[model samples]
Structures are given as structure tokens and as C-alpha cells.
Target: MRRIFILIIGIAVLYSCRNKQTESNNIVKAIAQDTLSKTVAGTADVGDVSPKNDETVKLIQKQLKVLLKNDLKSMTNEDRYFYYEAFDLNNDKKDEYFVGFSNSYFCGSGGCSGYILNHDGSVINSFSVTDFPILVTTDSSEKFYNLLMKSGGLFHLVKMKNGKYPSNPSIEEKWKGEVPKESTKVLDIYEKKLEKYSF
Candidate 1:
């Protein structure tokens, strides 16, 4: 009788563990599905340009299309378009350029990938905001930036340092300040830009 009782207890424990494992897996799968369901969609309008140079607009459009085509070629079933804008972020006499892409792979809950192209045709920055990105603009220094509104009730601002993309800060000491709660977002931007530039 005691042997039978021990066997029953062992079976119960095994089934309990199995159920817990299945539940955990289900939760993980649900999160992954939710993330994949997010899509990024938006319009990028260019404000009036001084001197009204159509040549500059043409150049920006051509370069942006080429860059985006090359960058996203390997990804599967990609349907996206580049939205190019020219704005004077620093109030400098010269206008800076902004290029963003709409991603369909991850939709609905707001997961998308994009890059910021400098006026020189060099990519200065990039980002993937999981939440709905409300705004993407440069600061006074012409540093690329993004504002994300998360589903979980949080707001984040991701800023990339000037001339700092395409390469990581080699010195560990540079991370000295209190780590930004948005470190992951910052890091993702850096890494994406680096990957794009490295090729």
C-alpha cells in the first residue's frame, strides 16, 4: 500500500511539473506572437525647403530608395517604403535629412525598423521602436531622435549621439553615468546603425 501511495505521489508531481512547463511555454509563445503582430505605419512629410531646390529633393529620394533597398533585401516578405524629410533641426542655415521606413513584418502593437540618413548620403543612425513611435526628429545638434509610446504605459526618448553611430563607444568608462532606464533602446539603435554601416 505504501509503495502504491509513493508511486501515485510521484506521478502527481510529474504531471504538475509538466503542466507548469506547458503553461510557461504558452506564455512565451503568446508574447512572441503579440510582438510579431505589431506593424509600423506612418507618413513622412517634408516641410518647405528654403531656396526651393527640387534637385535636393530628387537627390534625397533617390539615395534613400537605394539605401533602403540594399538594407532590407535579405529580409523575407518585406513590403516597405522610405519616407524622406528635410528639416533644419539645429536651426543651422543648412537643412538636415531624415529618412524613415514603414515595416509590415511586425505590426499592430508597433514594432518597426528604420534608419536616419544624413544629408551627405551617409547613414548616421537607426532605430526599432517596439511601441508606436509618435515622433522621430532630430534635436538642436542634428542628433537623430525618436519618441516611443509603449502599450504598457511608458514613454521613452531615444537619442543617438552625433558621429557616434556605426561604431560603439570603445571605452567602457563612457558608460559611467547612472545607466539610463532606456539603455536597451539606446543600444539597439547603436547596434542597428553599426550593422548597416559596417556592410
Candidate 2:
């Protein structure tokens, strides 16, 4: 009777191990399939530029994870499209990912703000583009001087500094004390000469 009990226990443990292995395999397979399906199909969506490569897509997804605190890959096409952009107009020599978010429980007419991921992929700089669709326009004459725009004619001309920008000055460490620039323009303020509401 004791021998029989030991044999049964061994079988049960083996079965449980197999089940766990199967579950892990299934999860890995699902992730591989999802990645394989990634495409520049977002062109028809709200972004000014579609994510053209896997690196760009993965980086944008990482930024989305930081901002939304969830995997935006599961969101519907319309919702995802309105909030994200992955491209290289920033002239950081690396692509940037931008996302717009609202402070309220849900986005209202008041509009949300923008978060731009830095080149190294570890930090982001914040500015208000008001709301989506956050239109990114590159300057033909100057590189990295991208114009960010939202609805209600809200616009901001943001220049990506050659180095990291502070995420939050209140937090210390990351604060660079505002690098000197030839232009004293306030980044998020809108101007008519820079164009308005139209990308």
C-alpha cells in the first residue's frame, strides 16, 4: 500500500511538470506569432509615419508599456493608432517614440500631453501636444527641430538637444539646467509662422 502511494505521487508530479512545460511553450509560440505579424500596416492609421522596422516597432511598444502601464499591443487598432508614433525626424541618429495621454480617467476635449523617448531607449522627455493625433513634422532646413501638433490648432516646436533632457527637474540627477541655445524660443508654445493645425 505504501509503495503504491509513492508511485502515484511520482506520476502526479511528472504530470504537473509536463503541464507547466506545455503552458510555457504555448506562451512562447503565441509571442513569436504576434511578432511575426507586425507590419507597417499602421499607415492608414493616424500617425504621420508608420513604424518601418522591427526595432522601431519594438521601441514604440516599450514606450507604450511605460506610458500606459500595459501592453498596448492588445488595444484596438483605432486606440493604438491615435496615440503612438515611431520614426526618426528627431535627428538623434536614433528613432524616437512618442505617445499622447490624458490626465483624466479617459481622454476629454481638453487634450492630453506627449512623451518622447530618448535615443538610448531608457528615458523620455515630456511636453504637451494637447492631444492626438500628435502630428510630427520635420524641418526641411534643420534636423531634430520637429514640430508637434494636436487639434484646436495647438502646436509646439521642440528641438531635441544633442544630449539627454531632464525627465523631471524636481527629481534632480537628470536635470541639465537648460542648455544654452541660439534661439530662446519656449518649446511648447505655438506660433503662426511655424504653421498651425495642418501637418
Candidate 3:
């Protein structure tokens, strides 16, 4: 009786151990899937945006990586990274992507080792910032609106001209929330589209 009792307890311990291992493996798999989704859709950030399709998401990432690797090869910031967003700057229903890089050069938040790409994956323009634009969006005429900090820490509005933002933007107001002055409907639509694609 004693020997039988010991065997039963041993079997229970082994089964419990196996269940724990399986649970651990499942957790790892879930984490990996979440990471892949974030990388593919670029929607891990509530403040950012990206392509609404899987193919476009992968392509945008590849294009941005190539541009940063081959084009900016001379740079030497080990921590340098890129964040991209796909939006229709021209309201053409086609997507344009912006690749922003991390570097010490940006004195403020909106700065990028800057590259804005067209639908064809071609660069439209690139520029760095002293006080990076806190808000970047477009107008009905497709003009880019950049809200940035200027002298005396005042917030200001700068419009893009021919794919280039002005180096010296006039003060508009103090920095507000991240929301742009663009229509709320567009933001809402994009967020919904993002959810549909991600799931």
C-alpha cells in the first residue's frame, strides 16, 4: 500500500510539471505573435499610424530599412532606430510613408533622421528639427501642417512647401495635446481601419 501511494503522488507531480511547461510555451507563442502584429501593422503606438494592409505594412518596413541602411550607412548611432507611419498627405486615397529616425540631433519630439516617402516608395523630402513638430498633418490643399516649438518655448505652425517644412516656423501657441488640427473623422476612420486589419 505504501509503495502504491508513493507512485500515485509521483505521477501527479510529473503531470503538473508538464502542464506548467505547456503553459509557459503558450505564453511565449502569444508574445511572439503580438510582436509580429506590432511590427507588421505599426499600430503599437496610439499616436502613430501605418499602412492598412499586410503587404503594404511589410513593404513599408522593408523600404524604410533599405533607405536607412544603404542611404545613411555613414552614420554611427548604435541606438538609431526608425518609426514609420503611412498616411495620405495628398488626400488621394493612396498612402505615403514617413520614416523618422532616432538621433541626438532632434531637439524636440517630432524630429526624424527625416524621410517622407511617396506611394512609389520614393523619398519626397527629408529634414531634421531643432524643436521637432509636436503635431504633423495636412490641409485640404495637401499642405503639411507642423506644430513646433520656437523661441521662448512658444508653439507655432509651419506649413510644408514643395515637400519641405520651413526651418524657422512662426510661433502659433504653446504645445497642446498630440491631436492635430485635422478632422477628427479622419483620425477615427484610420483607427477603425487599423483595428480591422490588425485582428
Best by lDDT: 3
lDDT of 2 by residue, 1-199 (tens): 9999999999999999999999999999986666544323222222312334556546656655666666455555444532344555445666565544433433455555556666555555665425444434324223554444433443343334554433222222221233322221211222312111100
Per-candidate TM vs. native?
A: 0.40, 0.38, 0.44
Query: What's the alpha carbon RMSD for model 3?
Result: 10.2
Where model 2 places Cα greater than 4 Å from the true spot, the runs are 1-82, 101-106, 140-143, 160-199
Per-candidate clashes come to: 7, 0, 3
lDDT of residue 81 for candidate 3: 47
Error (Å) of candidate 2 at residue 160 is 4.1
For candidate 1, which ten residues in a row score worst on lDDT? 166-175
Model 3 ranges with Cα > 4 A deviation: 1-77, 105-112, 130-133, 137-153, 167-199
Error of 2 at 107 (Å): 2.8
TM-score of 2: 0.38
lDDT of 1 by residue, 1-199 (tens): 9999999999999999999999999999986665444311112222321233566556655765566566456545444434444554444456555444445643334444555556666666554543323333333223433333232334443344555332211211122234333211221322233111111
lDDT of 3 by residue, 28-117 (tens): 999778866864553344233333556665665676667556545564454344445566656577776655444453335543345567
Candidate 2 lDDT trough over 10 residues, lowest sum: 190-199
Model 3: which residue pairs collide?
155-172, 155-173, 156-172
